[model samples]
Target: MTKAANFIWYELMTPDPAGAASFYGAVVGWTIAAHNDAAVGGVDYRMIVRGDGGNAGGVLALGADMLAGGARPGWLGYLEVADVDAAIDAIKADGGAVQMPATDLPVGRIAMVSDPQGAHFYIMDPIPPEDAVPGEGGVFSVTEAQHVRWNELATSDPDAAIAFYKKHFGWGQEGEMDMGPLGAYRFLQRGDVMIGAVMPLMEGYPVPVWNFYLGVDDIDRARAAVTANGGTITSEPMEIPGGEYAMNAIDPQGAPIGFVGPRKS
Candidate 1:
């Protein structure tokens, strides 16, 4: 059987590439790299890196043509699957919609999918194998800077989202976490790995959306860097009851993202 999907890369589509690059560089200590052929639909792209010089993620220049077609500024998460065709079939069979059919890229094959509840994610089959043992550059590397540690899907129908993902991805339910009046948080596990999560959207929120969490060594420093770089901090830094410290923020173009520091036990 194929191993469960692993999240490998994330990219943000925003209106301002320079500003987004500057903001993220300060906040996450990323080194911004520009590519001559990074354009998709004719828009420029900027690559982000950790201070140690490893590629962390990417940002796209969302031009007017993109906005006119009804694209919103948001972060895109990529998960590694064993076979893109099989994943797309499972997704459609489970009632989810395919935003984009499987397309081949030099790096891998990719498909954009929306869950039954409307949260979007991309699945990929990297050119290189993804299930290689750790320390051998599997899907991601901790020594290169923190890889994606978690993905949270905020949706209107949490149960339906959970069912669809479980059917398509073979994720098992871990348990529910109480968020006071916000309702219950459902956690999922892939094999023995806890890759991401699903949660019901609170009242007054719009459609289902997914948020990506980038791991950091210091939460407070990350928060400070965000403010210093012209990004807005949507939430104040606070320790969750479980001991992790996190803060939500938006880049210069108003794309939602977050940073999390390890819990002190």
Candidate 2:
């Protein structure tokens, strides 16, 4: 099945990709591979392989030019679409802005865009390899570890944001969980599975952002690894549905990250 409107890839843009490799390798148990693809603009881009040997995403090294140009460490997800150009057009018409013009790569055509509310993400129409199995999805999974488990958005306007995404990406606001004072945590579903949620921007976040959650085997162990490897646990894991725990953190390089798993410890 074509994953239109679904997340097809995840990426990390950090000033220190080497240190990020060590940080994430410890916290998430990912093995970073050295890949020198000159087509990638001569950056030290590395593929992140989970314990299952399948890649979950890539780590992009932020060049000096990027940092000097006001780029900061953050995680960006790629939302797959049927037509990259058409999507860009719609995004603009709907009050969104294009941060980077659509660029074609060997893998597929991609473009960095922000929603009307200013939460940034990518939209791609990937070109699968000849050996790629038909209709198979990678990187983002609902029942896998290491791969991104959920994609959450913290925006200024939850209602308008939901409407904008629904109108453009074919996403459905299936249901919501009440969060009391913080407002409702509206779940965003592509089909039957709940991919993630959208909520009001929390106290310290200030600006709108996208936070992708990485699945782990043990939430406590993952928290331990974060502090051990120079990362900071900003939120303690709280048990969610299915008895799993989720928490937020800031990686050593200042990129915000999240994790979800059982408390085996």
Candidate 3:
């Protein structure tokens, strides 16, 4: 089993699944396949199959019930936990809030939760195949185009948010960088790999949330495709510490996503 507190799944809830599929297919070269398993949630679930034959993520249409409840189209990542109910209790005890109670789904039991600073994510106990290898599903062998390369969190209170995750998810602080008046940008690790960082929410951010960055072959090329395919480019390619570059954007259905890749010299 993949250890608890590891980010195991990514899902996008959008009002237009077809449009999102087409826009992201162009953006990341993913081949979208409808998940029609009768045991599963049926037609609303669509799998994002990467060009290399690995499952990247899934696209779920925001249903009527969610819309009536004021749920907006967005992306949600799932962190694997040993016990869903136990994790939910810990989250609540630590001053976090539960948007949805733990419930049984076709693939697992999951609960939607928000951190103390209000960034939303899920805790799931997934049901994998009987013969599946441990630590295989939802993990990438290499950082490449079409795979999730990084995870970033912007929150109102970075210290409290980090402490909350550390308590329940076993997340460790690898290191941090002081960004002057913006405070410290803290790197988070599941074990060895630096999965992402947590920082204070920047100006103009709608809300505190986690943003996952998908890798691409070329950041410039991905930016071009995004604007040409009905997506809005929020930021151009900017070089980061790792020698590569990244950009952020909103998909056609209003869900924000990001891309990271090399820039041709």
Candidate 4:
């Protein structure tokens, strides 16, 4: 049985899909194409295409009903599991909750779930297409530009969050960085890869959530493109241990996003 280890896909839910497509096209260099779905009465869901023409994830236009349900424009990640329904059962057994029950799409079976601390993400059992490549990885890549580079989680309980994921998803705590008063920034590993880190949930985030960082060629140039395209920078570029720079920003409609790249002066 394969455990859920990687965040295989990412989706940004915004009220303005075309505008988001334009914004990311400038900032992250992703091209979007509308996915014609007969299921949701043809909802405006666009695919995020990377430079290598691989699927990064999607940009979904939030409907009025979704907005009324208090859905805001934010990015969410999807973990590929062997069985979506079984994954939900295990999540519940481990003190997690399912926001959406298991449902079958044209492509796969999926359910929305949260850890015990309430950080939400999806679990899916994908049905590969006839032309799909064997063992092909999804949206995330540690070194590829225009792909998700990191999966940072600001959880209410870092210790418990780390334990839960390790037991369920085969993740391990690899290292630690003491952030003085903000709490420990502990690294998370999936097999041999350092996928991301977990930190103490900060002051303003109402709930625990995953912040996926996309890769760019140059941090400074991407920063300028963000402001030029109507996004707001939340955190200024900060140099990390690897000598790369990372920063946080929000889309024009207020969806939080992150970027990682070289800081070229």
User: What's each prediction's clash count?
Assistant: 0, 0, 0, 0
Identify the runs in model 1 with alpha carbons over 4 angstroms from their true place: 36-43, 129-146, 262-265
Worst 10 residues of 1 by lDDT: 135-144
Model 2 residue runs over 4 Å out of place are: 1-4
Instruction: Compose the digit string of candidate 4's lDDT tens values, residues 176-241.
Output: 999999989999988788999999999878899999999999999999999999999999999998
lDDT of 3: 0.83
Among all candidates shown, the one with the greatest TM-score: 2
Compose the digit string of candidate 3's lDDT tens values, residues 23-110.
Answer: 8888889877744345455447878889878788787778888789898888888888888888888788888899989988888898
lDDT of 1 by residue, 1-265 (tens): 4465666778788887777777776766666665523433344766676766566767777788889998878898887777889888878887788998898866678899888887888888777546545312232432223455567889988888887767666778787889888888888787776666788896535888888777777788788788888888988776753577877888778888877785333
TM-score winner between 2 and 4, please give it. Answer: 2
Cα lDDT, all candidates:
0.73, 0.88, 0.83, 0.88
Quote the positional error of residue 138 for candidate 1 in Å: 6.4
- What is the Cα-based lDDT of residue 199 in candidate 4? 97
- Which prediction has more favorable TM-score, 2 or 3? 2
Please give each candidate's TM-score: 0.86, 0.95, 0.93, 0.95
What are the per-residue Cα lDDT tens digits for candidate 2 across 1-265? 3343778788899888778889988988998776544655656787888988887888888889999998899999988888999989989999999999999887889999999999999988888879875334588887677989988999999999999888888788977889999999999998787899999998998789999999988998999999999999999999998889999999999999999988885
Cα deviation of 89, candidate 1, in Å: 2.5
Worst 10 residues of 3 by lDDT: 34-43
Q: Rank the candidates by lDDT, best first.
A: 4, 2, 3, 1
